[model samples]
Target chain A: MRLAIMGAGAVGASVAELASAYGHEVTAIADSNSAAIDPNGLDTEAALATKRASGTVGDDSPESVLEAEYDVLVEATPTTLGDAEPGYSHTVSALERDRHVVLANKGPIAERYDEVRAHERNSEGRVSFDATVGGAIPVLTTIDDIGRSNVTAVRGVLNGTANFILSRMAAESLDYEHVLAEAQDLGVAEADPTFDVDGTDAALKCVILANVLFGGGYALSDAAVEGIREIPGAALQLAAEDGQTIRLIGEVVDEEIRVGPRLVPETGTLAVSGTQNIVQLQTERAGRLNISGRGAGGDETATAVLGDINRLL
Target chain B: MSERTDVRAHTVRLELDDEPGELLNALGPIAEHGGNLLSIFHERGNRTPRGRIPVEVDVEATPERFDRIVDALRQTGVNVVQAGAERYSEELTVLLIGHLIETDFSDTLSRFERCSSASVAEVSLTVADDATDASSARIRLAAHAGETDRALDTIREVATEKDITVISPLTGGDAV
Candidate 1:
């Protein structure tokens, strides 16, 4: 398979590395600033080395990568809300050119799923975005396997950073700021951390899951999102008095998608600690199916992206 | 296929004014909402603190039909005390030892009640001679089939937060 990856971040770079080792041709690779393109397949090792040393994949612009010959376009750009630009435009262009798309970017699929599906409808190439929701957990694929009609509800502890902070706060009886700082020091949280802490990340994942399940063209803005920012230590203490532990849970029931700190029995499957993610699917026939794993990492998420590429093959 | 194939039995408690035709009036709404009556316990001699007659009605209907029955009862001004008695197919027993009363035993019990797949079947609490001393509670929970582990997990979670020790039932396979 000939591949073009638009974002040279951790996920894109890792996919380029793994797919090359798997014998796929890396035809084009691009960063926000520059791009490297080769119709005969670029050298994956040389491109990564150049990115490490020169801070750009190559001097070729992003437009050139979109124009280059490729069988599939891997969208690994950073997520954004409105229009989901750059990533969205890149995806639209690839699908228009009759190339399959596998997304590691949550924004485009989450914000403009209807438009992406419309593009997939007109093109010969389809879109696969297993990494968009649950990292390596295969959530979307599991829903696919179960047949979407059997799935009643999809809920989970989707954000590892939020789960880490809440789990530490509950165990150590510490305040949010203290646990968040500890998480930051351990590199489990980004420095800014607003997206994870403010619940937008989990809400976006739930929105994507909702669209996949309901197919009613649900968008990120349609979700009822609440973060753990205002949760006080005293609330945890009070909940402990009632034998309940608070976890940041993202749930999608039909068209309603919500994300916030919810009181879940700590012994339940969703009460995972550290940087772990869990997805639970309520099915009409199979009862409740729970799947948990590492929700993020360059290589971990790239594993999902590569899996989508293999399915395409 | 019959509509009764997936029907479940649910019990609803009602508080009615001690009057002539109150029981008959309440039965009308249940039958009108397509519920088949299983049994009824109309205690006319008993009076609640509010001086109302206590009645328990058991009816069989699908979940959606049951919802409509409860709504119709409320809309018609029938004082519905409790909507439904949660039922489950399997049971598990666990002993919780700690400051059960101090940490709010009712709250702990309600946590079990809140789980959709599990319900508190019965509870027995024992307190030490000294009022301030520790206590223990034997809790029996009814859960849906194949969901005992999830129910036990909920109990374990609540016990952990309250600093209580739990002795759970033998849940076969991987005892360790």
Candidate 2:
């Protein structure tokens, strides 16, 4: 498959780097300001090096990459809320040309599912967003394998930054601020860290899961979210005394999406620690299924995008 | 025969005056109502705020007989704290984080008990050394079977009113 990637962020760059290994060609790649396009094939290493040294990928406008010839357009851009901007428009442009879209961006699919599906219904292109929900955890694909109707509920620790803080607080008896600062220093959490810690990141993932499980009509605003910011170290101590621990859990059950700090057994499957993620699917026939792994990072997320492209083939 | 088939386990919590014959007096109503005695957990040392001993009596009886047993106990002036069959078969544990001491923790527990569908079974509070800092409490609630959602909703409401953050147990999954 010839892939055109939008947004030269970590995930996008990693996708471009790993595309050839997965038997795919990078026809075009674009960052916010510049574009590197080649109808035949672009040098992945050269483009990435240019992005590293100079602040741009190439001299071409970012808009030109959308028009480049490609079999799959990987939307690996930064996630935005509400309008889900440039990403949504870029997705529509690809779908308008009947090009398949593999999304690493949660914005378009999380905020605008029905509209994207409506476009897909008219066009021959299909959309796959396995990378959006749980990085490389294959949460959406697992739901697909189990059959959407057969899966009753989906819950997990979808965000790494929140989980890191909570687990560190429990293990070392540290406060939220201390663990969060440590996480930022270790590069496990971003500098701002608002979205990941405030439950918005996990809520967006849950909203995306709700949209998948219930077949659209759910958005970020529809979710009831509470962050782990207010949880003091005393809470973790109380939980640990009872043989349980606190985790930032996102749940999509019975058409309701909720993300908040939840209690799970200390040794339970959902109690994954230190930036790890776990998704549990309640299947009607198969009982319960748990899938856990590194739920973020550029290379891990790029694998999901590549997997989606392989599926398109 | 049908009544025998319908018999189920029911628990009744009672506050009896710490006096001689109080245990025998509580047992009299169950025998009179055709309720077979399953067990009796008489906590002689544990007393309620009113200075009465707490007793947990388990009985096996039909729904009709259970209702009559409860009524007979109440009519006999026996203080029945809680009574139902399968009403609290499920337990939910949640962590409450915030100024628990400042917000009157006892009042919060009483409000939960007042819901009727749930009862505060156990609580462990951890207070910070700094008096004004936030405290945390682990509360175990016994809720009616299939009514965990209602119990959670009630908890959320009370917590919201008191400006507390609730870390609820993940439900609908056996792993947690």
Candidate 3:
């Protein structure tokens, strides 16, 4: 398969670098401002090196990649809410051309599922976004194998940044601000950590899961979200006294999406520490299934994007 | 008479006024209702917030007899903290964080207890070193089976009115 990756960030760059190892050719690659395109297959290393040195992927305009020849379009753009612009438009452009779309961006699917599905219904292309939810955890694929109807509920610690701060606060008896600063210093959290700390990131993942589980019509506004910012160190201490810990949990159950700080048993499945992520699925016949792994990273998330591309094969 | 006559064990928690022959008076209802007394765990030293002794009585009775025994104990003025396995069978633990002292923590607890589907079972509160700082309380609630959602809804409503944050347990899963 020939791939055209949007967004020259970590995930997209990793996908471009690893495409050949997976027996795929990179026909085009685009950052926000520039693009590198070759119908036969472009030099992946040179494009990445140019991006590092000159802050541009190539001399070509970013819009040109959308018109380039490619079998799969990988949307690895930064996630945005409300309109879910560039990502949604990029997805539509691929489906419009009947080319498959593999998404690492959660904005399009989380905010506009029905519209995307509607577009796919009219095209010969198919959409796969295994990277949207739990990064490399294969949450959606597991649901697909189990049959979405048979999966009754999905819940887990979906955000790694929130999990890191909460776990550190519990372990060292530190407050939220102190641990969050440490996380930022460790590069586990971004300097502007509002998205992860405010629970919007996890809620977006839950919204996508809800869309897959219930077939559509769910968005960020529909979710009931509460972040871990207001949780004091005393709260973790009080919970620990009772053999429990506090984690930012996202749940998709009873046809509703909810993300908040929940009290889970300290040793329970959902209490994953550090930057780890876990997803627990309640099935109708086979009981509960748990899948845990590194929820975010360049290679980890790119592996998920590549997995979707493999399925497109 | 073709009803559920098979004997089953049931546990009932009761609060009794510390008085002479109070235990004897409480046991009279079980025997009168045709329930076989299994055992009595009478905690004489520990007293409830209402200054009443807590007693846990296990009885073997038919489903019909168990219901009658519970009703009889209640009608006879025995404070039935919890009765039968099905009633208040679900236990939910949540952390309430905020200015608990300034917000009247006692009133918050009373509001939870006033809800018909649930009752407060245990609470552990911790205040920060600075008196005016935010405090946290771990409240354990025993709710009627399948009423866990309603119990949580009541807590959320009260928390919202008091400007408190509730870290609820993950419900409808094994975490509960």
Which regions in candidate 2 have their CA more than 4 angstroms from the true location? B1-89, B143-148
Instruction: List TM-score per model, in order.
Output: 0.67, 0.83, 0.82
Looking at model 3, the pairs that clash are none
Model 3 TM-score is 0.82
Residue runs of model 1 more than 4 Å from their true location after superposition: B1-176
Per-residue error at B126 for model 3, in Å? 1.8
* Chain B TM-score of every predicted model: 0.51, 0.54, 0.52
Which pairs in model 1 have colliding backbones?
none
Q: How do the residues A1-313 of candidate 1 rate in per-residue lDDT, one tens digit apiece? A: 9999989999999999998766688999999989999999898889889999999888899779999999999999999897998889989999999999999999998999999999999999889999988798999999999999999888888999999998888888877899989999999999999999989999999989998998848888898776876555544554455455677888888568888776665566777888899998889988888899999989989999988899997
Compare candidates 1 and 2 on TM-score and give the better one: 2
Per-candidate Cα RMSD to the true structure, in Å, reads: 13.2, 9.8, 10.3
lDDT of 3 by residue, A1-313 (tens): 9999999999999999999999999999999989999999999999999999999999999889999999999999999999898999999999999999999999999999999999999999999999998999999999999999999999999999999999999999999999999999999999999999999999999999999999999999999998998888989999999999999999999998999999999998899999999999999999899999999999999999999999987
Docking quality level of the chain pair in candidate 3: acceptable
| Residue A168, model 1: Cα distance from true site in angstroms | 1.1
- Backbone clashes for every candidate come to 0, 1, 0
